[model samples]
Target chain A: MEIISFASAVAGLGILGIIFGTGLAYASVKFAVEEDPKKIEIDEALPGANCGACGFAGCSSYAEAVAKGEEGIDSCPVGGEELIEKIADIMGVAASSSDEKKTAKVLCQGGNQETFNKAEYQGVPSCQAASMVDNFKSCQYGCLGFGDCAAVCDFDAIVMNDNGLPEIDPDKCAECGVCVTECPRSLIEIVSSNEDVITNCKSALKGKEVKVVCEKGCFGCTICAKKCPVDAIEMEDNLPVVDTEGCIGCGVCVKNCPTDAFVEVDF
Target chain B: MQELFLLFMAASITNNFVLMQFLGICPFLGVSKEVPTAFSMGLATTFVMVTSAVVTWLVETVILVPLGIEYLQYIAFILVISSFVQLTELFVKKVSPPLYKALGIFLPLITTNCAILGLALLISMEGYGFIQSAVFGLGAGVGFTIAIVLMAGIRERLEFADVPKPLKGAPITLLVAGIMALAFTGLAM
Candidate 1:
């Protein structure tokens, strides 16, 4: 009697498994939905970070949009140009040539070597925290040097050097624009990799006031603005703003700036 | 009718799955980030719970009781619940792509949700008849929905409030969950 009951239990459970398994198998085939082969290929080629840097919910959704020709291949900043080429090859279309590979630029040169300290900030070591406090730097508009941008970079592209300024590695940067918003002083800008001349100062103070705080501050000298061959450099609120469209990739502004405010970035 | 009403009231409020019993806390916290998503998850869970309850009850009465193989109840209940979830996923994908998209990963995730399993176990333990088991399942699902939707509404408002840096994100969410649990205790009275 005991042997018969044990055999029945095994048979019963086995039958249950087989029944459910076969039923599910039939249902899966009956309810199968068709998906684009190109979308799957595109999704596989993508970085799959699903960072939402492409304005889509995730990598797969972005792939669907790209497959259907709704969004451009260059929309994914995290994937950069190489992924665009791969995606374009899958879609059998030429990638957009006008979209340049971009990188972030730290617009301030107010490192520890160049600037003076107003007070020793003993509060939070974060830039946001230091900014909320009295802001220890003499130049209020300078980089807080608390490495907030460095901390926020998902790609580990930005590093805080001994000089206390974030050194952005151009090759590693995907230009996701995370660091641009992370800075408390808004001292970071996304610029074209090939573009060179950059005003590395953000202080609105006059030359004398700027000289009192930072050694490399762009104190409204306007020399680069005046000397630009195409008039691309403009002095706005004591800082040089480069009109990217109008400017050529010449080192003329770099050659003229007295305080070394303009830097020639090597792309 | 009164006994059924009492059972439902007791299951939904006094013996709540998420708050009182703490059975499906994962979705209660995870999917409760937005109201629409939480409500959809709630509805999906409810549908699965009610259906699985009926099926599992039939399996217990028709097979396990007669065979006296009651020890295999857990394994049998799990098999039925997971297969049903798979079938529902396929049917939903074919019939309503929008809802499938909205539910997203949470639809398949319902297979692992212990609340459904707990409902099945409780039904068998309490020896509820077919109609009582269905009522209990429905009530449990409704309780889960109310808890999650209420949490989603609170979290949406929390986004704008001035939260301390350390207490942001998960910390604040847990604090809110604790307070909500405390408030639900009043419903027991």
Candidate 2:
């Protein structure tokens, strides 16, 4: 009786399995979705970082959008030129020549010694929260040193130095712009990684006013502008802007800045 | 009619799958971060639950009870639930690409949700009729949706709140879930 019952149990389960398995096999083919083959190809060509640099949620979504002709071919900043070319080939379109390799550059040089705090902030150690209150630091436009940029970076590119300033590693940075957006004072900028000249200060305060707040503050003295041999520096809104296109990357401006506001980024 | 109502009530509220019974806490916590995503997860789980209930009931009545192989119910129920989830996933993918993208990995995750297997087991154990089992499954899904969506709403608000440092993130989420569980217990009275 036991042997017969066990055999029946096995037979019943096997029949049930076979029925469901066939049903599923048929359903899979019947319900198969036709997807663009180019989307998968383009997705493979992408860096798959899912950094949201292209305003899409991830590389796959961006690939789907590109495959559908909804987004431009060169939308991904981290993909650089090669991946863009590969994606363009998959999409059968001419790749744009405007793709530039960029890196996040911290525009502030003021650290613990160069900058002083007006009040000791004891609340959440976020730059956004710290900057909400007035006079957290004497300098209104300097790195708050709360490491908000470091916190937002998924690539581990930004690190808080011992001097309470974010130091961005150019090699590790994907140029996704998360740190650039996270800075409360807008002290980080995405610049051409090949370009060496960067204005290390973002202070809009005039010469004497900047000296009182932070020692390394750009005083808008126009000294770097005057010293530029290629006429690459221009004073805009009391700040010297480096014309990266014209700038020959000579260290002349770096030497001429009295407050050391102009800096030459090392590759 | 009364029996059906009581079954629905028991599945949905008095024995709620998420808050009261705590059967499928993985997706309840994982997908409950966003309201829309949580709602989608709830709907997908509901669809799977009801379908599993019907199919399992059929299997129990037609195969298991007649053969007196009631002991094979657990393994059979799992096999049926997983296969059904797979089939539903394929159907959804074919019908709506946008939904397929939005649901992402959570759709396949419904296979492992113990709440589904528990529902199938419960229906068989109670000797519920086909319609009653279906209603119970639907009620359980609705109950799960309500709990998860409510949790999502609270978590969204908590984003702006100045929660204490030690009790931030998962700690605070768990505390809220515990409090919600306590409040749900009030429904029993």
Candidate 3:
């Protein structure tokens, strides 16, 4: 009885398998969708970061969009120049000339010793939550040292230094702009990696007002603006904005700043 | 007609495959993160369930019973359901790429869902007629959809809520699902 039942089971399952297998084979041919072959190639070329830096959900979807000619070859910011060139080659399109690489620069130099707090913020350690209360710190426009930007960075490029300030490593940075958006004080900016002259402060408060709270705060002294020989520095709202096009990487502004707010970044 | 209505009510509400019987809990938690995606997943599962029900019923009554191979029901049902899911996936992909993308991995996952197999076995055990079995499958699928979509809605709101640190992610989600199961028990009455 056992052997007969086993044989019948095997026969029943075999017949079922053959029927379903043929059905699936017929369905596959009948339901075949025409997919672009270039999509797979472009997907392979992508970095697969799924960083959403290009406003797409993931690398595969971005590849599909690019393959469909909906998005340009330069849409991916994390892939950099080499990936773009490879994708262009796959698509048989001329790659655009490489743009200057940009990296995140921390504008605030106010570390633990340089800045003072008004009251202890014992709530959630988020910068957004801390910024909502006016009494968290004395300087309203400086780094909160809460590491909000560092938390949002997927590249592991931003780290809180020993002094409780985020220091971005340019080499590790992808310039995806997540850190830039996460900063409540807007103290992180994406700047040309090759540009040596950078204002290390983002404060627009006058010199006297800044000196009361943070020692490292930009006093908006206008010394850098006055000393610029090419008139590259313009004072707007008590802050010196440097025009990269006009500035020739001269150290005049760096030496002339009263508060040493102008910093010279190497590489 | 009355019997069919009762069967639908029993399968959908009084004895929901997800909330009541606790079948297919994987997709219940996994795909219930978003409403639109949850709805799509539910729809895909529904399509598979209904089709698998009809196909498996025909196989059991016509081939398995006559050949006295009733012991092979489990393997035969799995084989029928999985292939049905595969065929449905290909058809949905070709017809609507957006829906196919929305369904994503959950479409293929319907093959392994115990709810489909359970429905088939329950119908055969209960000796439901052809139309009655089809209705039961449809009702069970609808029950799964309602449960998942409601769970998704609750979870979407939970995102903005200031939930406590200890009960933040999955713990809170499971707690919410338990509460929803409690609430669904009211439907039984």
Candidate 4:
């Protein structure tokens, strides 16, 4: 009886396996979807970061778009230049060197020391949370210093400095613009690395209010705008907007600004 | 009729597969990110659970008990459950392309989901008849759907919430799951 039971168990299981195996094999062939071979290849070739930096859901969706010729090969910023070349080679197209390497610029210089607090914000230690609850920072338009931008940066390129402002490492920044969207005050901007000048402040307050708020606030004294030899600086809403096309990188604005709101880009 | 109704309610709510029993947690957490996706996963799992329950019940009664090899129940149940999952995947892919895309890799993952196996084992362990096993499986699946859908709704809201930095992603999700489990205890009369 024991031997018969053992044989029955083995035979029963073995029969079941064969039945399931055949059933699955038949179903797979019967229900096969016609997938694009090139899409699979492109998916393998592309960096599978799925960061949504390319405006797609993930690497697979992006690959499908590229395979269908719906998206350009240069759309992926996280992959950088090498991925572009690889994709171009797969697609049988000449790789366009269209992307200029960019870096994130923190437009606010009003760190913890530079600005006074209107209230002691004891809420959640996130920029979004701080900004929503009356923004304790004296400058309403400055970095909240809670490192919301730093938190979203997938590349680990952003760090909160001693003064509670984000310091971006240019070398590691992929310019994916995730940090740009993360900032509650929209203080972070992606700019061409080769740009010679950047405004270190985003304060829109008038000269008097600016003085009351932050030492580093752009008081709109119009010194840099007046000093611009090529009329590259325009005063808009009590802030100096630098026009890169007409600006000569002479560092005149950097030198002339009393509050030192404009600084020459180091890199 | 009353007994069947009670059995269904107990399986779906009081003895909920995901919340109360804590089976099939992988998909419960992984697929509960969005409402639509979570609903789809729940439905797919429900279909598999019901079918596997009936099939495994037949296997236990007709084959294992007759052969006096009830110890082979585990392997036999696993084989039956995995095959049904594969068959379901094929049917879903052929019938609805959008759902197939939405489910993505999760469709195949149901093969390993312990909830279906647990239902099969529970049915046989309780010596339930074929009709009773089927009803129990359906109830268990409905229970899973409710738990996952609830989790997804809360997670969607949590996206905009000011969750603390340390408890942002997985930690907060686990905390929410724990809280949900505690809340479900209220239904356990």
Task: Please name the candidate that would achieve the greatest lDDT relative to the true structure.
Answer: 1
> Model 1: DockQ against the native?
0.21
lDDT tens digits by residue: candidate 2, A114-191: 889888888888999988888668888888898999989977988999999999888788787988888878999988
Stretches of candidate 2 exceeding 4 Å from the true structure: A35-102, A108-174, A179-187, A202-253, B96-106, B164-169
For model 1, the local distance difference test gives 0.85
Candidate 4: list runs displaced more than 4 Å: A1-7, A34-101, A108-166, A179-188, A196-264, B66-68, B101-106, B155-189
Residue B22 of model 2 has an lDDT of: 83
Q: Return whichever of 1 and 2 wins on lDDT.
A: 1
lDDT digits (tens) for residues B112-184 of candidate 4: 6778788899999899999999999999999999998999999999999999999986689889999998988
Question: Which 10 residues in a row give candidate 2 chain B its minimum summed lDDT?
Answer: B101-110
lDDT of 4 by residue, A36-145 (tens): 98898898987775444454445766788899988888987778899988888998776435655578999988998889898888978898888788667899998889
Off by over 4 Å in 3: A1-10, A35-103, A109-174, A181-186, A202-258, B98-106, B186-189
Chain B TM-score for all candidates, comma-separated: 0.94, 0.93, 0.93, 0.93
Clashing pairs in 4: none
Question: Regarding lDDT, does 1 or 4 come out ahead?
Answer: 1
Interface RMSD of each: 6.8, 7.7, 7.7, 7.0
True contacts kept of 4: 0.41
Candidate 1 lDDT over B1-189, as tens digits, reads: 999998998888887899889888766766677888778778888888899999999999998888889999999999988888878878888888987786543555577788989999999999999999999999999989898899989999998999999997668878998898888888884
RMSD of each: 8.6, 7.9, 7.7, 7.9
Which of the two candidates, 3 or 4, achieves a greater lDDT against the reference? 4
In model 4, the Cα lDDT at residue A171 comes to 84
Chain A, candidate 4, TM-score of 0.69
Report the C-alpha lDDT of model 1 over A121-179, residue by residue, as the tens digit: 79778999888876579999999898999989978999999999999998898788999
List model 2 lDDT by residue over B111-148, tens digit each: 77778898898888888898998999999998998888
User: What C-alpha lDDT do the candidate models reach, one value each?
Assistant: 0.85, 0.83, 0.82, 0.84
